[model samples]
Target chain A: MTVGIVGYGAFVPRRRIKLEEIAKVWGADAPAYKRGLQLFEKSVPGADEDTVTMSVEAARNALARSGGVDPADIGALYIGSESHPYAVKPSGTIVAEAIGAVPALHVADLEFACKAGTESLFIAQALVKAGEVKYAVGIGADTSQGAPGDALEYSAAAGAAAFIFGADEDLILAEIVDTYSWTTDTPDFWRREYMHYPRHGSRFTGEPAYFRHSMNSARGMMDKAGLEPGDFAYAIFHQPNGKFPMRVGKKLGFTNEQLETGWLSPWLGNTYSGASPIGLTAVLDIASPGDLILLTSFGSGAGSDSFVIRVTGRISEVQDLAPKTREQLDENKIYLEYGAYAKLRGKIRMAE
Target chain B: MFSPARAWREYPQRYRLEAAKCTECSKILYPPRLVCPACGGRTFTPEILPREGKVVTFTVIRVPPAGFTEQTPLPLALVELANGVRLMVQIGDVENPETLEIGMPVRLEFRRISWDGEAGVIFYGHKAVRAGS
Candidate 1:
C-alpha cells in the first residue's frame, strides 16, 4: 500500500505591502526591521480572505492537478492552520464542503503552528497506506496577521496549498519512501491565544527551533530510509523566514541546488499552517520521475515530520493545477495601506 | 514589522506581481519585508504599485466582519490590474453590491477599511474605484 501525491495545488494572495512604507515609518535606521528580520515586504491578507478561502482555492487546484477527479472519490479531508478562523469550528469541514468531497469522508484539522501542513502530509501518507482511505486531501492555509510594529507582521502573508493523496495512482509525484520525527521543549516560536501574533526568542529560535529540529529530523528520516541528502534533488523545510531554512539546509549538507527548491514564505510569509506543504506543492510542479524530494516540518512544540517523495513516470502528463494556484497569486493582487492591513488583520474597530 | 533583509531574501510575491522588488530577483512585495522572499538575499529596494486593475473575482457582503456591519451589502471586489496584480477592495459607486461581476474593470484608490476608535488609529486598505475616464 504505497502512498504518494496524486494531485497538487497552491494559492497566494494577490496583494502586497511595500517595504519602503515599513522603513519610512519604523525609522530610517530601525535596526530590527532592517537587520535582524530579513523580510523586505510581505503579503497583506485581503479583507475577503481567511484560512478557509485560501484553503478552498488551493484544494481546487489540487483536484485539477489530479486530472479533475470526481470529488466523491476522495475518502479523507484535512486542513492544517494555526490561524484558523474559529476556535470551535473545523476549517477542514468548511474546506471539505467547499471542495465537494464525499459527505461522509474523514475530516479533521491539525494544529502545529508552521508544521501543521507537513504533519498533515505525514498523517495522510499513513492513512492512504493503511487503506483507511483511497484518497486523502491535505490543505495548509493561513491569513496570519502579525502585531503592528511587531516582528511577525512584516513576514506574515496569506496563502494556501493542497495535496491529494491516494494509492493505485498511476501518476505518483513522490512516494513516502521513509519518515522520521524529533522533538524537544523548544520555545523558539509561539503565538498564544488572546494574542493575535507570535512571539519568538529570536536568535534562540534559529539554532533550536529551526536549525536543530529541521536538521535532526531530516537526518533521522534519511538514516531510517538508508538514504542521504545526496540522494534527493531538493529539500523544502518550514520557513519562518528566508534565512532559517538556509541555515538548516547547510547544516544538513544539502547543496545550494537542494535548498533552492520551492522557497515559498519569504514573499508569502509563514502562511503558518501552509508553509511546508506549499513548498512541497511547488516541488511537485517541476520535479520529474525518479527524482527524489525531501520534506522537513518543524512545529514549535517543538516537533518535526520528515517524508521522502520519489516522482514516478506517470507524473509527466499532470494537468498542472499549480498554475491556477500560481495564477491566483501571480496574475493579480491588491495593495493595502497600513490601515487596511490592520483591518484585514482584524486590528481596527468594527461596525458592530 | 517590515524586515528589509527579508524583502531581499524572499521574492515569491515580489517577482511574481508582488509590488516591492529586490535588487536580485526582480520581484515585488507589498507590506515589504526585512529580506526578499525570493533570492534569500538581505538587500532590498522599493517599488510602488500602479493604481489600476480589474475585478478578476469578488463577492458582496451583506453581513460584514467585525468592523464592516455598517456597510452591509457592500460591493467588495477582488481585482486584477492590467499589470497583473490582484487586490481585494470595495467597488465604489456600486449599484448593487450583489450584482458585481468577475471581470469588471476598476481602478485602485485609498479609503478607510477600518477604524481604531480606542487608539484614534484610522486604518486604510485598498479599494476598487469603478473605472471611469
Candidate 2:
C-alpha cells in the first residue's frame, strides 16, 4: 500500500508591501534588508483574510485538482500554523467543513513553529499507510506576525499550501518514497501566551537551530533511503529567510539549479509554516514524471521533516486543474504602503 | 467573548451559501425565506448560491463602520448571479475602487469579516475578488 499525494494547492495573498516601505517606516536602510535577507517584498493579507480563510481557499484548489475525489472520503484533516486565529478552537475543523470534508473526519490544530505543517503531512501519510483512512488533508498556513521594527517584520508574510494524500492509483500525483524527522529541544525562538510577538535567540536561530536540524534531517533521510543529493532532480528546504535555504542547499551538495525553482522566499518572503510546502507546490506544478524531489522543513525549537518524493505520470493531468502557484504570485498585485499595512494587520490600535 | 449563538445561526448562510429558491416561479431568494414574494408560494427548495457573478451596482464607503475603519473606502456591490439571484457583497483584490465598472465579473472568496472586540469570536464570510485574479 504505497500512499502518495493525490492533489496539491497553494494560496498567496495579492497585496504586497515592498521592503523599502517597511524599512522606511522604521528608519532602517532598505537595501540592507534586501541584500542581507534576500527579500524584496512580502504579501499582506486584507482586512478580511487570515490563516483560516487562506487555508480554505487553498484546500478548495486542492480539491479541484483531486480528479473529482469525493470530499466525504477524506477521513482526516489537520492544519498547522503559528497563528491559529483562535488559541482554543481547531482550525482543522473550520477548513474541513469549508472544503465539505466534515462530519466524519479526524481534525486538529497543530503548532510546532514552522515545521508543524510537515508534521501534519507525516501523520496523515502514516494513517493512509496503515489503512486507517482512505484519504487525508494537511495544510500549512499563516498570517504570521512580526513585531514592529523587528527583523522578523521584513519577512513574515501570509500564504497557505494544502496537500491531499491517498492510496488510489488513479489519483496519485507523486509517490512518497520515504520521510524522516529529526527533532530536539533546542529553543531558538518562542512567544509567551499573552505576548503579541515572538522573541528569537538571534544568532542562536542560525547554527544549532535551523542549520543543525535541517542538515541532519536531510542527511539522515538520504542515508535511510540509500540516495544522495545528486540522485534527486530538485531539493526544497525550509526558508525562514531567502538566504538560509540557498546556503543550506549548497552545504548539502545540491546544485543551484536543483534549488532554484522552489526558492520563492526572495520574491514572496518567508511564509513561516507555509514556506516549504508552498515551495513544493511550485515545483509540482512543473516537475516531470519519474522526477525525484527532496523536501525538508525546519521550525524553531527545533526540528526538520524531510521527505523523498517521486513525481508520477498523472501530475501533468491535474497540475493545471487549479491556478498555478507562480501565476498567483506574478499577476494582479496591489502594493500597499506601510501605514495601510499596519492598519490592515491590526498593528494600529482601534477605539472600543 | 465568543458567541456560540451568532456562530451557530449563520452557519448555513456563511459556510454553504444556503438560500431559498421558489419552485413555483423559479425565483431565487437569499437569506432563505419561507414565502416567495413573486408567487406567494410557501414551497421552496434549499438552494446553494453560485460563487461567481457580475457586478450590478456598487458604492464606495469612505467612512466605514466601527471595527471596519481599516477597510475604509471599501467597495460594496450588488451582484447578479447566473441563477438570476442578486445579492450584496463587499469587493476586494482591487487596487483602485474607482476603476470598478457595473458589469465587471467577480467571484466569491471566503475571508475574515471582523472579530468581536479585541478578544472574541472572529467572524468569517465571503467577499468578491475579480475573476481570474
lDDT of 1 by residue, A114-171 (tens): 7888777778778988888878888878777666776666677777888888886575
lDDT of each: 0.70, 0.89
Fraction of native A-B contacts kept, per candidate: 0.00, 0.79
lDDT of 1: 0.70
Cα lDDT, model 2, residue A42? 87
Which 10-residue window in model 1 chain A sums to the lowest lDDT? A321-330
Point to the candidate with the largest DockQ: 2
Interface RMSD of 2: 1.6
